[model samples]
Target: MYQYDAIDHQLVAERVAQFRDQTERFLNKELSEQEFLPLRLQNGLYVQRYAPMLRVAIPYGMLSSNQLRTLADISRRYDRGYGHFSTRQNLQFNWPKLEDVPDILAELAEVEMHAIQTSGNCIRNTTTDQYSGVIADEIVDPRPYCELIRQWSTFHPEYAFLPRKFKIAVNANENADRAATQVHDIGLHIKKNAAGEIGFKVIVGGGLGRTPMVGVTISDFIPRADLLTYLEAIVRVYNQHGRRDNKYKARIKILVKALGIDEFRLRVEEEWKHIKNNESTVPAAEFDRLQSFFTEPEYQTLTDNPSNLTEKLADSTGFSRWFERNTFPHKKAGYRIVTLTLKKAGQAPGDATAEQMEKAADLADKYSFNELRVSHEQNLVLADVQQDQLVDLWNDCKEAGFATPTLGLLTDMICCPGGDFCALANAKSIPIAEQIQAEFDNLDYLYDIGELDLNISGCMNACGHHHVGNIGILGVDKKGEEFYQVSIGGASGHDASIGKILGPSFAQEEISRVIRKLVDVYVSQRTAEEHFIDTYRRIGITQFKEAVYAKAN
Candidate 1:
């Protein structure tokens, strides 16, 4: 995690003071709601269906134990006793009182946190691979570059109000893209040239929400020095040429679709000539300074699978299952990346209670070098844990209800708050997610299903990233009734592709049955050890579609 310097601290504190005044003036009736609309949004305040919701930015999803404790305290005091971790890797408090939001902001500022630019039509949080530096195959640490983008884009006057909200994500790993870069407005895939110089393969005009698109590569590789200038050129072209009359078609993706990537690239290249080698170019010293913050944590020199690890795995099936499902190989020896699943029975997906947060913070302090990462999949990551402590950590997590051993399984679905909290949702998402989770509760069944990404969005907004799920479920409002539209064969990684819709929508009640049918189609036909996505691709959508609709009929 990047420690907040004096500048960072001052900036957040000042923003909090500014928003406090704005919020107070609005409440006094001196400022109208229309007048305060953008102001509030810029501070990450949203008037949800039921109550005000506040999104606090966790830049690149990095959080310290102290910060986590603060968030837990805030959840307990200002809002409900839990917070929803969104797909963007930010935490959302769904039930915060509008009047108390400024105080919330003030409290957050005390801990080097704020909600500035989390909302509004600016470049939102620049997300990246949750396992960036820790992942062995990653080309370089992307978090430093992510922080660079954060410093460059935050309160950028030029982009504060684009045609629509814009998002940028960077991925450093060449083997797999855990960051879902292909779906971002500007997806920066870091690569090295023949001479071993780091650069980016820039992908532009990709997003989900109404119009889902896979980003087209605009530049195969641009030097690291020109990153910000190139990024500015792209955003500048979008700001000037992007649609403003209709927000639905205002995204850069729509513009690129209209102009074609070729024409868009031509214009971006034309615009880049003037500002390409200006002050925006990253200074070597500055880059080094940012990189300095993300140095590897001190690790004890221990052997892999240290004392009792294999013995415990052999002894306890639960431990073995968790070891397989919840843990990942760390870049360092004797360390493992443990993901704590937030999806469990009877609770809404992506939500962590205040007590859970505090417990997680404590666990982070003990196990993960006082650092925790919030995954894009809405789970918590302890990036560095000694191999020997695996069982102890597993037991602690299991007691806390985050040890479901279903990281990439069907029950470990990514779901939005949907109609439960969000005003724009077409139908309820939590219930359906719960329903699917309950149906797939059996560990044996889940393990058999194998490596499925199930994502649910309450609407076309695609907050849950429904388009990229191996099995995607989207809520559609059909003549005032709630229904679900299912899709198959979508993925976010190397073979990034949007899911193809199955057939006509099904009622909420039939969702579990529908999912079961899809699962059956895969299970009955899959070759040995094939993942659900591979099976879907091998069999094609025809079989799954046939089975789902045939059973429905």
Candidate 2:
């Protein structure tokens, strides 16, 4: 985790003070609702269905125990006793009093966290693989570059307010697209060329909303030093030409689509000519400066697989299942990346209570060198847990309701708080997530079904990332009633693809049955080695579609 330097502290403190004055003026009637709209949005405040929602940035999803505790404290003191973690690796406080926001901002400042650039037509959080440096066989650790992007994008005068909000994600892993780089305004696939020098394969115009499109690759490689200036060119083009007339069509993805990839590339390249190789180009000293902050945590010398680990697996099936689902490979021989999935039996997919957050902090301090990472999938990560203590950690996680053994499984779905919270949502997503979780509570059944991504979105904004889920459930409004639409064969990762909708939308109550029918079809027809997604891709949507819409004989 990157600790804030003096300059970082000064910049954030100044922003907080500025926002405090702005908030006070708005409350004093000097700033009307319309006047305060962009002002508050710049600070990550949103007027939700019932109340205001404040989004706090977790830059590149990295956190320290102290930061997590501060967040838990903020959640408890300022709003309700819980916070909703969004798919973008940010936290949302749904019930914060508008007056208390400045105070919340001050508190967050103390922990080196803030809500800046989290909302409103500006460069938002720059996210990356949650398992950044921890992954085994990694190509490169992306945290430094992500931090570089953070510095380059935050309150950038040139891109302070674009035609629409923008997002950037970085992924160094070749095997998975955990960062969903293909669906970001700009996706950086960090890799080394034949000479083993680092660079980025830049993908632009990838996004989902009213219009969904996978971003097109703009450059085969942007040299490591040229990333920043090249990025400037990309955003500069979008800012100058992207749709400003309609918010719905303002994202860079739409701009890329309208201009076509070829012309978009040409535009970016033409713009890059003047900007590239300028002062903005990252220098060797700058890389060294940022990389110093992400030094390796002190790790113990131990076997990759301990005898106790094997014994514990044999002793308890529950622990074994959790270990299989929640733990990921680590670069360290003795360490593992353990995720505390928030998808318990009844809770919303990513909702973490204050107590849960505090306990997670405690666990992080105890086992993970006091460090944590928030996954894009809306779960918490103890990225350096030792293999020897796997059973003890599992027990602690089970007690804390984090060991649901559903990571990358059917119930481990990515979901957004829909009509229940967001004013923009067409229907409630939390209840739909609840329905599916309840339907697949059986551990044997869930594990047997194999890995599946079941994502739910309240609307087309795709905050839940429904377009990439194996079974994407989208909430729709038909006539006067709330209906749900189902899409199949969607996937996220190296092989990213959008899902295809089956047919007419169904009533809310029928969603669980529809999901069940889809699952049944997959289970019946899938080969022993095939996962739900692989089956869907192989057998196609016809079988699942028939089962979902099949009439009873």
lDDT of each: 0.92, 0.91
TM-score for each prediction?
A: 0.99, 0.99
Lowest summed lDDT over 10 consecutive residues: which window, candidate 1? 544-553
List, residue by residue over 1-553, the lDDT tens digit for candidate 2.
7888999999989999999999999889999999899989999999999999999999999999999999999999988899998889999999999999999999999989999999998999999989999888679899999999999998788888899999999999888889999988999999899999999999998888778788889998888999999999999999999998999989999888889999999999999999888889998999999999998888888778899998988988898899999999888888889999999978998999999999999999999999898999999999999999988999999899999998988999999999999998989999998988888889998989988999999999989999988999898988867899899888778788899999999999999999999989998999989998889888888988888877898
In candidate 1, how many Å is residue 347 off?
A: 1.4
For candidate 2, the TM-score is: 0.99
Can you write out model 1's per-residue Cα lDDT over 101-139, one digit (the tens) per residue?
989998888887889889989999999988988989889
Poorest stretch of ten by lDDT in candidate 2: 488-497
For model 2, the local distance difference test gives 0.91
